[model samples]
Target: MQPLLYNMPTLFAALGIRLKQISRIRQETDDSKPHVVELQQVTAVQVLVKAGQHIRGEPVEDRINSEEVRRLLDEFVPEWEVREERLYRRFETANWRVTLMTANAIGFLSEAAYHHPRLVLNYRSVEVYLTTHDAGGLTKLDFSLARKIEETVGWPRSREEMPGRRPKEWLRS
Candidate 1:
């Protein structure tokens, strides 16, 4: 019984997936805010270093700690074949929280990085790095990685309740 149950992910979704009705994902009307986008009906951001960023996104620190960033790289296990990257790290803490970002969102990140620090864009086939020493010697690679991961896992899949803390349905149109 235990082994069979463990193999079935839906069983966990029954007990694991706990939250509200998750009505719909709405965008904040106020432009003065930090581009607050909702997740429920849409994919809600799981974790934020500063939760308030939800209300008003803070200026991206533009600093990706080496050790910390490496740790996060562990979770986003990018699949070259699917061109999809999943959150491999736990979002329990900022030190360990993984953020995914992408190219299409460069403008937003450009502003977040103060539009100075050069960013590196890596393609699946060829990894590229564009580092600029002018805008304070620091790497914006974290933002790039975050954006990539975010774009890859867009629109969290719709799911119904199940047993354990397992996700059964990630199907989206």
Candidate 2:
């Protein structure tokens, strides 16, 4: 009897398909001079990995162009500056407590988004820099995180708008 076998690993790799599992298939075979087999059932789960595409069908993140970055900065986040292909901002706090508070806020946002940033903390200031390391440059993730940080830790004068007691100096951009 001749048995037909497939080199599944090699086949899957060549086809750019990731195999999850394959259950046993019931096969029908006839005994004769020439062996013949029929596959009754086959089940498979695979992920197709295409070039510049994620396995889960998510689009690959691309670096933003300089012109696009500039336009984004001008239109939405004028307070942010792009340098060395990174989105950057600095906030001067009233004191060490405010500095730590600002850093904690940024850390929380970064952790929640699963995106991290480079933070330089001083006695009375915090400098934030964001770039997507995997993408090798800034992407939407960086901009979105930066915007969240700004909204969470607003400018020093923003505190004046609060109804209750407010510190004269909280954070200055």
Q: Which candidate has the top score in TM-score?
A: 2
CA RMSD of each candidate after superposition: 15.5, 18.0
Per-residue alpha-carbon lDDT of candidate 1 for residues 47-76, written as tens digits (9 for 90 to 100): 222221212334434444556545545554
**Quality of model 1 by C-alpha lDDT:** 0.29
Which parts of model 2 have CA positions greater than 4 angstroms off? 1-60, 158-169
Most accurate candidate by lDDT? 2
The TM-score of predicted model 2 comes to 0.61
Model 1: CA > 4 A from native: 1-66, 77-104, 113-145, 148-173
> What's the distance in Å from true for residue 4, model 1?
56
Clashes of 2: 0
| TM-score, every prediction | 0.25, 0.61
lDDT by residue for model 2 over 11-124, one digit each (tens)?
Answer: 333323333543333345563344333222212111111112322336546888888888878876788898778999988887997788778767745754556689999998
